[model samples]
Target: MRADRLVSLVLLLRQHGRLSATALSRELEVSTRTVLRDIEALSAAGVPVYAERGRHGGFALLPGFQSELTGLNHDEALALLVAGSRRGAQAFGLGSALASAMRKVVDALPESHRATAAGAVQRLLIDPETDLLARRTDTEEVPDTVVTEVRRAVFAGHKLRIHYAAADQAPKWRTVDPIGLVTVRGQGYLLATRSGSDRTYRLSRILAAKQLAEPAQRPDRVDLDRAWQERSTRFRTGGDQVTVLARVNPSRRGDLVGTALAVRAEEEADADGWLRMELTFQDSRHAEWALWQLATNAEVVAPQWLRTSLRDRAAALATCYGVSS
Candidate 1:
C-alpha cells in the first residue's frame, strides 16, 4: 500500500500539475495531513515536488521532471496496457511488475482521465485456447533449450553440432546447417542442408544441439521457400508422367485437397455427392502415402501398373504379418 500510494502521488503530481489539498486528498482517498506528509516524503526523496498557493494550486512535479509516464502518447499508452496485461497473465514474472507499472501511469493521469485507462485494462484480456494447446503440446514436448538454440542457428546462419539418433543407428554427432524450422501437430522439423544435401531432421531425433561459431554459407542459394516448387519441377521434368484418377467420398474431399502430397488438377461432383478428383502425385511413394492417408474414402481408377504394385506391396505386408491372403 505504501508503494502504491507513493507511485500514485508521483502520477497525480506529474499529470495534474497543480491541485488544492482538498482535491489531492479526495483523489488519493486520504486526509489533507496525509497528502502533506506524502509531499514532504517526495521532497526528501529528491523528487521536485512543491505546493503552489493560487486559484489553481495543489501539488505539482517540476517542469523538467522525466518519468516513464511522461513521454507516452495515447497509442503507446494503450499498447503498453494491452501487452502488459497479456504478458502478465500468460508469462511468469510479469503480472506484479505490470500492475505496479500501471499504477505509476495511472497516478500520473489527471483525476478525470484515470477512470478511462483503468476501464480499458479491465475490458481487454487475452485467454488462449487451452484445450487446443494441450492437445498439441502433449504429443511431443521438445526440450525448450534445443528449440532456443535451433531458432538462434536458423536466424544467424550458423551451423549446428548435433547428436542425431535415428531408427537404424546409434546416436552420432554431425554438423549441419539449418535452413528452416517448422512445428506441425507438436512435431518439430529442422529442414537442413547437410554436407551439400537437403534433408529434414525431426526434433525428437536430436539428442543435443549447439550453434557453431562458424557461419554457414550455401553455394548457389537453395530457396527454402521454393522447396515444394523445386520438387514439383523435378517431377515435371522427369520421365514417365504417371496420372492418377481417384473417386473421393464427399466427406473426405477436404482431406484430399488440403493434403500436401496430393495436388488436385480437376474436381467433379456426382448426384450422390461424391467427388471425382484428378490428383497428381510426384512419384509412386507420394501416391502410396496419399492413398493410405485417404484410406477407404478413395480408390485409384487409373494407372494399372501403380495399382497392381500397391496390391502387391499390401499382400507382401500381409504375408509378413501371417494374415490369410
Candidate 2:
C-alpha cells in the first residue's frame, strides 16, 4: 500500500506540475505530515523531487521528468483502452479526464505492446448510437457545470442547493445532503436526502445547482452499493406497484424479465414450453409498456384490467394497419 501511495504521489506531481501538501493529503486521503514524509522519501530515493517555500509554493519534480511506471500487460492495456472508449464517463462529466488518462496509459506502454494495443482498441466498438433496428439510444444532456458542482459537493461532504424540475412538476429549489452520484443506462442521478428522507433526483432534471458552505448532514462514510440497494428496494415496493401473472414464450423469457421490476414467481415450463411467471411492475402503465414490447411472445394470464388494456392496444395497432376482424 505504501509503495502504491508513493507511485501515485509521483504521478500526481507529474500530472499537475505542483500541488500543496494539503491538496496532496486531500487527493491521497492522507494527512499533511504524511505527505511531507512521502516527499522526503521520494527525494531520498533520488526521484529529483524538490519543495518550493511560499504561500503558493508546493512540491514539484525537476523540469521534464517523467516516470517510467507503465506496468500494464497487453490484456490490461486493452481493457483500459476499451473502458476509455465507453460513453459512460461523459455522463459523469469526466470525458476529458478519461481521455487524458488513456493517453498517459498508452504512452507508458512499451513500444512493442503500444501499437498492437492501439490497433486492437480500434476494432472494438462500444455503445453504438443506433441499434439493429436503426433506433437511436437517446443520451440525456447533463450540463458540465451542474455535474461539476454536484460532484464537488458530494466529494467534499458539503450541502447542495438544486433547482430541480421533476416530470410534470414545477421547478423548485431544494437543499439536499448528497450521499453519492450514480449513473445507469447513460443517465445520472444524485442520491441524496432532503429533510433526512431518501431522495433521488435525475441529473438531467436539475436545472441549477450550488454547493453550500455548510458541511453536509450525512454519515462519515457511505457504502454506496448497499445504500443504492436499499433505495431501490424502497422505490420498487412503494409507488403505484402492481403484479401480473403471465405465460411467456421460452425464447422471449429474458426479454420480459429484463423489462419487469421483478419476477415474483416462476413455474416450470408447460408442455408447449411456455414459461409461467409472476412479475411486478411500478404501475399499470409500466406493465402495459413492457408487455407491448414483447408482441405475441408474452401473454398476460391474470389481472383482467391489464389483459383488457393489452387487447385494446392490439386492436388500435391493428386498426392502424387496416386489419378488420
| Candidate with maximal TM-score | 2
Q: Candidate 2 has which clashing residue pairs, if any? A: none
lDDT of 1 by residue, 1-325 (tens): 5555666677766656777778878777789899888888878988888878777766788896865534444323443654533432212112333444555657667758877887787786554435654642223545656766876787688989888888799999989977776544445677787888876777878888899989876544656657745644664656544458877888887877675344546567768666777876657776777777876677777777767876787788778899654
Q: Mark the regions of model 2 whose C-alpha exceeds 4 Å error after superposition.
A: 1-85, 110-113, 269-273, 323-325
RMSD of each: 13.2, 11.8
- Cα error, residue 100 of model 1, in Å, equals 15
Q: Estimate the TM-score of every prediction.
A: 0.44, 0.70
Clashing pairs in 1: 11-107, 11-108, 12-107, 19-57, 19-58
What does candidate 2's lDDT look like per residue over 1-325, in tens digits?
A: 5765677788777766799999999877689999999999999999999988899999999997877764544323433543643566777776544544565676677658977997898897888978999998777889989988998899889999999999999999999999998777778889999999999999999999999999999999899888889988998899898899999999999988898999999999989899999999999999999998999999999899999999998998888899655
Against the true structure, candidate 1 has what lDDT?
A: 0.67
